[model samples]
Target: MTVNIDKLTITTPAATSSTNLVALELSGAQAIERFPQYVTVLSDGSVKLTAPTKGASSKSTHRTRCEWSEPTNWTLASAADHWNRQRMTVTKVNSAQKVVISQIHVRGDDSPPVKVFWNKGNITMGFRTKYNQTTPVNSTVLKGVPLGAEFTVSIHATSKGVVTVEAKCNGVSGSSGALQLDATWGTRLFEFHGGVYNQVDYTNSTPAADGSICVISDLSLSHS
Candidate 1:
């Protein structure tokens, strides 16, 4: 009945490494609670996540994300179905008006199989059919979504690696249909990540006040 984040690890935009710039990470309740400005539990139990456009990012990547990653990784062959369901409201966005809201991430790969984004006023789905695909195929699944509005997104993968993604907002809905994953992904382990991921990369002159922020009011994950 409630969103549980006690076991999730939060990757904050806080600067960590001095050399190649990577953000600090916090795990569990005590650790995550220390970074309230980026991730915090609201009075109603919703989890708020923030990532500024001008924030520290991984040395290899250009953007930043105040995201919560599910610690447990599951394989496609390990279960009949694995799913992540999250309901969130985006309160702020970067100058691009785009942010990744939820995603299915591989254990070691930079490319995720599924990325559901809140782009402008449209709910877009970007998918990677191949494990190492450099770019994902993009499609608009739902529309009419506005800033500060509540929406729910769900993504699931079958044992055969068939992925399905859907979103609903203000009674409007959209789906990614059925996306078939190639065999290249069969050997990889995956997990779910949700929250605000800024689409823009920060530079020296980027304003600290500009960022992407969202609140996850409900969340759940399952494997069976």
Candidate 2:
């Protein structure tokens, strides 16, 4: 008898002009309509994202981010569990302020269950429980990640609202211990977000000169 094993492979589809692109604003009445020039999808399946000083809305000034959501409008309440992973590199940072690399958030909640950020030339991952909250209740998980370096980031959440974060940089790896979720989070829906989200606020007289550029080669998600 003879047996053979089959090989498996996965590929990213080429992006086109009509790709479903979405943007989120921390505060504003108008929704971002058009895809900005700063975002580009390369032929090699890598996405280049640049956060400019001026974002979509003028009512509030902060870094803008675009995320890929399946079905264009799925919410957190739509699923019981969530998982996401990505391989990315930071190419440029205009300032020392923290810039969000990715996040797992619920609809209408200002704060996300997990967020990965680059701050002062280091990587900081945090978990937040409360809804509409700005700060993470837990401490940073991984730090000291070098800029311009390639890294992997992941997030997982159970149906019970237990959350965890995994990260690897320069062959060093770590994970965030299980974080209990706030009761409010379970009442809403969630989504995965990636790109550059600057944490600094802009002023009228002096607009934010801070911006960041990131290249994401791989991004995956699953929910049940």
Candidate 3:
């Protein structure tokens, strides 16, 4: 069949513009608007995961993974029954130099008087300990501006384990508190230790950057 382009007749309203393109194909369209989805509450008045979309899944899911220069694997193990349980294993790392994981956000307890261990990191600014017993139990407390141009809190833990944090506002004294942090070798501290010591389990400790009154709730040792 021969196609006739000149005989084609289309209906349209008169326009002033000489070049006017009508609606194109359906594929030549873009997203117009987006709206929030409505969710129904359950009988117990609890909102549950009704949809498994990207945003919803993200807000409800927890991620965990490891990263390294070499092959490594991980597995989950019960802390209480460490001796009889299977721990997370780091399997392989062929050529992938790194592994990453977004761990689950743990906010189960917020009460003071909770025990935590120095999972890792330098407890005292300049003081480093080789053994758990050598660690200092912070005692002395103060309130003032840290020694810095911008906002920075100076926490000094002496050999006696005396810990003090001074808040500095514009390089002046602000507020301080006497905090008690316990350094113990527990399951939490296990990973932070045996390496460079850059990890610690800070329980019920409030060290805010916005200059909130930092306080030590229950600073003790965390054990497996």
| lDDT (0 to 1) per candidate | 0.87, 0.60, 0.19
In model 2, the worst 10-residue window by lDDT is 2-11
Q: Quick one: best TM-score, which candidate?
A: 1
Error of 1 at 76 (Å): 0.6
- lDDT score at residue 146, model 2, on the 0-100 scale: 74
Give the winner by lDDT.
Answer: 1
User: For residues 1-224, what per-residue lDDT tens digits would candidate 1 score against the true structure?
Assistant: 35678888888788875764688776848445677888778889888888888877877877888888888788899999988999999999999999998899998878988998999988898899998899999999899889989999999899999999999999988898999999999999998888988888778888878899998899988999
Off by over 4 Å in 2: 1-36, 58-61, 66-80, 204-209
Return the TM-score for each candidate structure: 0.95, 0.73, 0.19
Q: Candidate 1, TM-score vs. the true structure?
A: 0.95
Q: Give the range of the ten consecutive residues with the poorest summed lDDT in model 3.
A: 27-36
Q: What is the alpha-carbon lDDT for the whole of candidate 2?
A: 0.60
- How many clashes in candidate 1? 0
Query: Residues 19-124, candidate 3, lDDT per residue (tens digit)?
Result: 5332111110110011112122235332111111111111122211111011111111223211110011112211111111101111221121111211111112
Clashing pairs in 1: none
Consecutive 10-residue window with the lowest summed lDDT within model 1: 24-33
lDDT per residue as tens, model 2, 80-101: 8778777888887755567777
Candidates 2 and 3 compared: the better one by TM-score is 2
